[model samples]
Target: MKPRLLLTLATVLGFSAGTVQADTIGDPVRGEQLFKRDCAACHQLGEGAVNRVGPQLNGVFDRRAGSLASFSYSKGMSRMGADGLTWTLETLDAYLANPRSLVSGTRMSYRGMKEQQDRSALMAYLRTWSDKPQNIPEASPTARPTVPELDPKILAIQGDPAYGEYLSSECTTCHQRDGSDQGIPAITRWPQDDFVAAMHAYKQKLRPHPVMQMMASRLTDEEIASLAAYFAALD
Candidate 1:
């Protein structure tokens, strides 16, 4: 494809793209597997669920962040609840991606889930417990998973690594070149499409990180692709 055409396509996709939504819940069985692998140790759900290390997630959807009267929550989580952080599909996805990013002093130590599919499945599983028509009130349609899938054409862009290297100085300030994560998550060696999609999310303010949003807001589609290329090739 011509360079001009590629740029045009990127611009068109970058601005107009939105998350994919489905009318029905994702696979709860798969979600249950993920939960068992990652969350079950700390939390309990479904019938006979009770507070474990983490609060029981029976009615998690639409609930305040730390509003369970029986649970002792971190001050930061409680503050987030007081500040009106409700658990909806959007907010839940953000929190699952990176808990610390949303609630700085939260006690949940698990690193966030990176795969959008996995998060959506988990959200679906959680939603099943929260929104049973036979038991609870009808759930809002907006509570469905809002997972975004990048356009294949946009992902096909081949960025200039040299330009990416030049632009990467800003990124290296927070993301270490050596791939070691201190407080922030590691960005090195991520898949090119994942990097691009994440930057776009930050640019759109969907990821909810102020610094990332500010940084991504200044990046063009090509610049983002360049950065993704550069980072993916990094050690």
Candidate 2:
């Protein structure tokens, strides 16, 4: 094949692969169910949809935050738009998980959907309503332009397991140390980094577990790192 033709073929294949990956990650049917259950009260979609508690969501993807002329927006959302924030699948997932955390001082109050599968489904369903749905590949081998920002405080902390062990007693009451699978998950044997990330997610209200969000809210970054270290070290 000629070099230009080969290049064209490669581009076409790559685009086809990305589209397939995006379509498969979330089931639109399930996503619609979750939307009605969790988000229908506040938002709407399609032509002639009206904004309620939240803005109408038609043409949401790739649009700047607070860009819509028809609805009232929160100060933080307007600031984000001023800072050049646009909605994409990755951004949408983060916002869906925790609206206030993604954009500090957002007016939206709902805690977030914890089930990743549900979020994926909701995202797929939402794509159909958008004027332009961005199709980001699932776990793309290529680097993404957008990365979720991490809290500097948490990133700076060097964890101490000894200190963490002392702090972990409170966590054990609910999360449980025993290996048995029950209502709550077993908390021990986590990797240090994953544990830290999960704790920070809770603290930042990204995880949407009400009690954990409240509990993590009071913890300092050092404390979270320490607790992560302690839990991670145990069997």
Candidate 3:
């Protein structure tokens, strides 16, 4: 095979494997649980749920920020609304990651939700009340941290296969013992480079699925490499 052709094939395969494991939606049940624990004090979800510290959020979807008729909005928020910014899944994800970063002096005092999975679940829960929930945006192929960039460095580190074997138990719950595709795809016997790339894609949010993002985020590079080594040897 030509050198250029091999490189192209590798790149395509790397991204294809990563994209296959991508997840976009989250468990709404988990979302509701997170909301009740984290946001219930300030925001209300049900129709009869009235505004507490923050305004009632029944119609927040696609509604301009700070434009709620009955509630008093901060100067920053009002300015944002006047500028025609509406709440969509994308906007909400950004805002929830860091409110002050998005809008400089918002009255909401709670610190932003830092976890991507948590934000995704919260968004799902919030959408239940929205008349028109924004659809999950398609993940672009060029998002970032491609296989060529991230794969080699992690693979360079020596990984402990025994520890990885211990870690593989939880994975077996979704990925079958026989490594057969049963709705969810199997992760066994993946090439080390491809596995590293896929995990990085999830951790970097290049791939969708907040749950996978969260799971990937929790794993260190060494751990990922270890798992890769373990799975590669499994075949």
Candidate 4:
């Protein structure tokens, strides 16, 4: 390559890289403004409010899902808690973009923030609550045993377990037997309602997880409910 051309190319590359880096570094001040406007309706800021529509945002940044004492989380959130997933900035960004996409059946009714700037702002705002450095939890080292106790919920309505099993065949690619995978986590022992909500989320595009999006897109509401029942019934 010619010296002048090489230098010009290098300069362009450097500028592009710098711009990308700048974009990812969220502004906490802007984030706070966005939070108050968008998220404050459901979530309370600071440590003062005990509980509101949603759990208090105080210390929520590093907290695990469903860890709040006061709020009643959906089964999906509870499952996330049991699995030990924490709310880091990156995770929060993704969740804020689409709640169901992150945890499948979370009961967070708010639609996602479509803009990247909005998501980044939300993440920055959430960071103010946590005292410690934030990190997401690793998958459980031990394999999860299927809980037979949950069968009643899954089998509550008349449906064929055989059909449920057949329908669930599609989920095995991502959910896996053990539930540990990249982006995709384990679903064993998940709450029945949460499972239902997750499918609903996907069907509605409220949850935008790619594989679940595709799968949920394919199934009817009844099919989703049936699959939820079957998974809940699995031991």
Q: Each model's TM-score, in the order given?
A: 0.51, 0.48, 0.48, 0.46
Candidate ranking under TM-score, highest first, comes to: 1, 3, 2, 4
Q: lDDT tens string, model 2, 4-98?
A: 56547868876543453212547879999998999888999767888999998876777899999988899999999999988877888899998
Q: What digit string (tens of lDDT, one per residue) describes model 4 on residues 34-138?
A: 888887888888767567787888777667889987789889899988998887666776888888898888878988899987776666666655564324333
Better of 1 and 4 by TM-score: 1
Clashes of each: 0, 0, 2, 3
With a 3 Å backbone cut-off (N, CA, C), the pairs that clash in candidate 1 are none
Cand. 4 TM to true fold: 0.46
Ranking by lDDT: 1, 2, 3, 4
Write candidate 3's Cα lDDT for 10-72 as tens digits. 688665434554344456789899988988889888769787899887857678899888888
Candidate 2 ranges beyond 4 A from true positions? 1-23, 132-235
Q: Where does model 4 exceed 4 Å of error?
A: 1-24, 132-235
Q: What is the lDDT of residue 218 in candidate 3?
A: 65
How many pairs of residues in model 1 come into backbone collision? 0
Candidate models: Cα lDDT each: 0.84, 0.78, 0.77, 0.69
Best by lDDT: 1
- Which sections of candidate 1 miss by over 4 Å? 1-25, 133-138, 142-235
Best by TM-score: 1
Worst 10 residues of 1 by lDDT: 140-149
